[model samples]
Target: MKQVLVIVLALFIVGCSSTSKVALSEDRFLLTSNDPEYGYTENKPIELGGFLRGTKSAGAHIEYFEGLMGPNGEKVKVTRLGSCCEFEDKSMPFGGGLLDRYQLTYEGQKKPVIIYVNLYKFNKPLAPMGFALL
Candidate 1:
């Protein structure tokens, strides 16, 4: 009985630790918008793609850069875009990453436009990553 109790306690501790790690990783990248028209928005869906760094077996890093073009042809470059880890869980086919949202405001516009950028890197074999405005 004592051995069983010890095993159960160890399992429980390991499970909680794993959960906390995931949560911490998730919180690293934050999603936020500042458009009064849209109010505060969080956790918006985003498509991921672009230059990938690292490998699946040893973990990977995903990188993407995009720009927002205004009606006048002015372009705003998005820097420090986003990132995701590709080797969190091997059992799961798909790996999870972080999402970032940006709000662009310009003169003469009544409201700012909200853009969603998703960063994802998975261990499973997948297609090259890229992103498009939605």
Candidate 2:
């Protein structure tokens, strides 16, 4: 019985860690907005949603970024800086959720760009201004 319980727990952990869901397409990923403030600001961060699907929050972040490219359609590398800016949300634990921040760099970018993402609520992911959809 103990062995069975251990195996079950291990399976659960593996399942939660895998990012099995593919992100939405570029056209469907971002909102049609030209303002840089749209995704740069934590107040209006890009929404990745799908948090209730049982996958880990970090996995969702990676999944979404996989479908993105640089402003000039260049391949971009992303690093998760960390989580910040907690806000009230009925669907999230303790009635709030935190936004995830990422640093994006491309071949020609002079400086890395910081973008915000939300996972707690389901919102249409918007392609940030100055970013190219892949």
Candidate 3:
């Protein structure tokens, strides 16, 4: 009986402890919208979707950055993008996640360039936080 109980407890603990680590990859799961227009690609004028603002009780965590990349892989003019009153959450457990979408353009580039998107954090100039490619 003791062994059985110990085994059960161990199994329970293992099951409860199992958690999927949040990876900042190009995985589709990172996207909060299903507009099919959000993601990395050769497509210019990428769309940085919007999100719903979190409430006082339960909030969402959403962040984004955009910029143009240079030939030497240098980021320039990094911009912090957010929804209306969404970035105002300066408290713990940030407000709601992104829901709406915004667009960006890759102009003035004479050659093939790379654009990036950093999620949930401020990426450096031309540096994406989540996932991005040329």
Candidate 4:
């Protein structure tokens, strides 16, 4: 019985960690992460892709960056145009529901900007969460 329980627990953990991919359109894809620290470890800029799916409260933590840095270490302008959180989970803190949509304006940007989304509620100041150069 103990061995069975262990197997079940292991399976459960693995299942919970698995990623879910949603196709928004032909070129756009949605990547989800139960762990909020998904694309935040690398210290380099991330080439903009489709979209980042994490906590809805991600917008609150986004106000910390001055702008994005280009691959050549040049400063790229970043502006938070808007945000949309239609799908939200109230159970989560600060209403960080299913998805927090953030629209940004990138000046002279032709690619994506890498950012670190702050998963912690208390930590207001944070690194880049991620950016889409569009």
Candidate 5:
């Protein structure tokens, strides 16, 4: 009887430990964008489509950078994208990098929220003489 009791106790401990690990691993962040239109704007808002997850109690950060422009007046350069993670709450404001501003909008209750971010506030002027809008 003593051996059986010890075995059961060990099994219970193992099960509890596994459960805790799974709970920790369940946290994650999700980001997506669609119908993306890029242009240089002064204090203009750009719509970034995406959803976030694993942020039940907090919000995430997002980074934005300017892309290179082609001769045909099109953007070609791409920079490192930043991200937000574990925000204090969904209502908290989060932004990063150049023009790092994000507005999150959620659908009803069960749907993912849309993240609208401004991309140019973080960009630096290319020419020392003057600044040109893309």
Candidate 6:
């Protein structure tokens, strides 16, 4: 009986443990959130279109932040963190692409804010909420 109980406990522990880790870039369980936050300020992102702007690589991302400012006209620094949230699109031959996530930091702010840019498609983007347009 003692040996049987030990085996049962070991099996239970092994069953609870996960063998694989969930990757940050996993596309199997991604949320499709294309809704633009035009009214509210939360999760506001500037639409940076590369194909429409005739740009490749990070050129379009650079142009979007060029001459852009913070809420109080503070010089905003744009940093390309990486890409996330892949989805299907007619623009790409593979029918899928990822949005580039940028880290925007400027003076007089608590910390930094992350902005998502969709460079695959072109849509004239308005100034992001709480940002000053040049």
**Stretches > 4 Å off in candidate 1:** 1-46, 51-67, 77-94, 121-134
Q: Give me the runs in candidate 6 sitting further than 4 Å from their true place.
A: 1-45, 51-58
In Å, residue 125's CA in model 6 sits off its true spot by 1.4
Per-candidate TM-score against the hidden true structure: 0.32, 0.66, 0.24, 0.29, 0.21, 0.58
Which stretches in model 4 have alpha-carbon errors above 4 Å?
Answer: 1-63, 93-108, 111-134
- Winner on lDDT (2 vs 3): 2
Q: Ranking by lDDT, best first?
A: 2, 6, 1, 4, 3, 5
Reference-based lDDT, residue 119, model 2: 73
- Tens digits of per-residue lDDT for model 2 on 1-134? 99999999999999875433334445643544577687799888887766566744535555667767665466678888999998887866679889989888877689898998887765646568766554
Model 1 RMSD, rounded to 1 decimal: 18.9
Residue 65 local lDDT, model 2: 79
* lDDT of candidate 4 over 27-111, digit per residue (tens): 2112222234533433222223223346554444433334333322344455443333333336545564222223333434566
Model 6: lDDT to the true structure: 0.59
Q: Write the per-residue lDDT of candidate 5 for residues 1-134, one digit (tens) a residue.
A: 99999999999999875542211111111111122322223233342222244332112123222321222222222332344322232333453333333322112224222222433122221211111113
In the range 3-71, model 6's lDDT, one tens digit per residue, is: 999999999888765322222232321222234463123234455566444455436656557745665
Residue runs of model 2 more than 4 Å from their true location after superposition: 1-32, 55-60, 91-93
| lDDT tens readout by residue for model 3, 1-134 | 99999999999988765432222334422333343333333232233323223432122112333222322323333334433223323432465333222233333335432332323332122223332333
CA lDDT of every candidate: 0.37, 0.72, 0.34, 0.36, 0.29, 0.59
List the lowest-lDDT window of 10 residues for candidate 4. Answer: 21-30
The Cα error of candidate 4 at residue 27, in Å, is 30
Q: What is the C-alpha RMSD of each candidate to the true structure, in Å?
A: 18.9, 13.3, 16.0, 17.7, 19.1, 16.8
Measured with C-alpha atoms, the lDDT of residue 132 in candidate 5 is 15
Which one is best on lDDT?
A: 2
